[model samples]
Target: MTFQVARMNEQESAAWLGLVTVCQLLPAALDSQLKQDSGMTHFEFSVLSVLRFAPDHTLRMTALAETTSSTLPRLSHVCSRLEKRGLTDRFPCPEDGRATNVRLTPEGRNALVRAMPGHIDTARRLVVDALTPEQLDALAQVTAVIRGQLDDGRPARGNPFA
Candidate 1:
């Protein structure tokens, strides 16, 4: 089988490049702020934020991986790091002893709460404040379309925001 490939035209190329820049820059900006203010990377913040909202601040490791759109190996590695810092605790899942569960500690919750204001400010400065309300709504709709396509056929994971 063969597939045809073509170069992007001017408008398409501009739109694609803009999307790529957002993908590359946004996370780095978010991470930089989180790391500087909270000593946690954005991914770490994200994981903690998810766990903070989980039932009893606890979830099976597999469930965390799914919720965070993370690979098991990467999630395990991060979980180990969090454990070392006493931000989270990992234990045998009661429902399945062979599986693991992670719970956020009080310290972790404190860190997340402290990080929240700065993170929100960074997001607003970089994105929300940069766009008009109409543009923001349009951006959300467009991204939702793209995200839906990307997540198609996967289990639906709630947004990491509270």
Candidate 2:
């Protein structure tokens, strides 16, 4: 069989590389800030924050995983850790016995509240403050377009920008 490989043009390559670089570096930076300030990883902070805003401070495991862009297994593991720390609780959903539900404890809410200031500051230092308002808007638009393309028509829940 014969095949041809398509290569990106210089402009496409530059854009792709820039995106890759940001994806690689941003997570570590956010994790570092969260770990130092709150004794939690960035993903853990996200889970708590999402739960804090959820109705009744609870969400189904599947819904939480979708909102956080995490796999169910990974979210389950994180939830387990949070449960052990007394920050969250997971139990079988009453309305749907087949589904699991997770809730942020009051302590989890407090922890998230404490984490937010430092997290926001770090975000501003690393990203928000680095962009002009116009650039920020463009970035949001660009990411939204990409997210729509990748999300398989699944509506996003509780997206702050949305």
Please write out the lDDT profile of model 2 over residues 33-71, one tens digit for every residue: 999999999999989988888899999999999898899
- lDDT values for all models: 0.91, 0.90
Per-prediction TM-score, please? 0.94, 0.94
Across 1-162, the per-residue lDDT of candidate 1 in tens digits comes to 999999999999999999998899999999899999999998899899999999999999899998888999999999899989999999999989999999999999998999999999999999999999999999989988887888996756877762
Every candidate's CA RMSD: 1.6, 1.7
Model 2 residue 60 CA deviation in Å: 1.1
The true-versus-predicted C-alpha distance at residue 92 of model 1, in Å, is 0.6
Candidate 2 residue 41 C-alpha distance from true site, Å:
0.9
The all-Cα superposition gives candidate 1 an RMSD in Å to the true structure of: 1.6
Cα displacement (angstroms), candidate 2, residue 124, comes to: 0.3
